[model samples]
Target: MDKTLHYLFDPLCGWCYGAAPAVSGLLESGGVSLELLPTGLFSGEGARPLDDAFAAYAWSNDQRIERLTGQRFSEKYRDRILGDRRQLFDSGPATVALTAVSLTEPARELEALEAIQHARYVDGNDVISLATLADLLRALGLDDAAAKLSHPDAELLGANQARMSRAQALMREFGARGVPTLIVGSGAKRQLLDHAAAYSNPRALISQLEAA
Candidate 1:
């Protein structure tokens, strides 16, 4: 049987960043098709101001994630991104940016995501801003994707919305409460893998997928 892994995540999610290595492992395994589905969890109505209390909470959670996954959540990120109160913690721009890449250069979507995540968590760049997101896309040599951000096509917007809806529906079906949820297999026979293993033991994750 053919297998596919649907990775549901939000760009601004620290746990999703933590899960990055395992996801990359799955992609590199060549065992199954990998589909990235953005959950839009921190976009639109889900966005909120970067206030003091939330920044502290986010940094603490990020530290724990770093310990678990060994993904860097730098002090620069802590002071600049989590400290900035002027901009909202919105994943809309980043999501749209990835969607643009998915639409224009399908093969490079994951690369775009990894770059965007690195820009936010490591370099302390504002992935939440359109201009910054455009620059990141350009840096990755995705000039077409960078251009699309300034004038998004209707198809791009629709695809993003549809993907988000499908991801959210799957989340509800699985009774999952947050991002970094993984569903292995295709169609009705699909199963939800243990999300925690994506951070703790990626080899086990590959084993599960190979079995699936």
Candidate 2:
């Protein structure tokens, strides 16, 4: 039987940013089909202000993630993204952007997610804004996705809603509580890979997926 991997993550998640390398490794390895699922953990009703306490906590956690995964968390992001209180730390726009890519350019969905993450976490861009997300999609040559943003239809909304629901249901099934979760295999034989290995060791993660 063919093997597949379902990656559940939120774009605003720091750990998800850390797990990017390993996810990339899996995509490049060509041993298993990879599906990117956005959980919408930080979107819609879950959105909240990036208050000082949350900002500090997020930074501290981000530092640990950087140490573990060698991903960069820059001062620019800390100052511009975490420090700015004018905007809410909502993942709705980014999630919609990824869904747009998935609908229009399925093959490039992963790339679009990586670029959106990079725009927020690395370049300190406001990815939560539709305009900013459209620009990011365009920069990635995803003009179809960019166009969809200007005039999203029921199909796009339904797809995004269904993806979020599926991701949430999967999390419940696995008793998982956070982003960057991985489910390998499929149907009754599927298994949840250890989330820790996604950042601590990419090769080990690949091996685990292969074994599953």
Alpha-carbon lDDT, every model: 0.90, 0.90
Query: What TM-score would each prediction reach against the true structure?
Result: 0.96, 0.96
Total clashes in model 1, counting residue pairs 3 or more apart in sequence or in different chains: 0
- The list of candidate 1 runs beyond 4 A from truth reads none
Number of clashes recorded per candidate: 0, 0
Q: How high a TM-score does candidate 2 get?
A: 0.96
- Candidate 2 per-residue C-alpha lDDT over 33-141 given as tens digits, one digit per residue, 9 for 90 to 100: 8788999999999999999998999999999999999999988899999999887989998998899999999989988988888888889999989999999899889
lDDT of 1 by residue, 1-212 (tens): 36889999999999999999999998788857878899999998999999999999999999999999999998889888998999799999899999899888988888899999999899998888889999889999999999999788898789889989999999999898998999997666889888888888999988888777
C-alpha root-mean-square deviation, candidate 1: 1.3
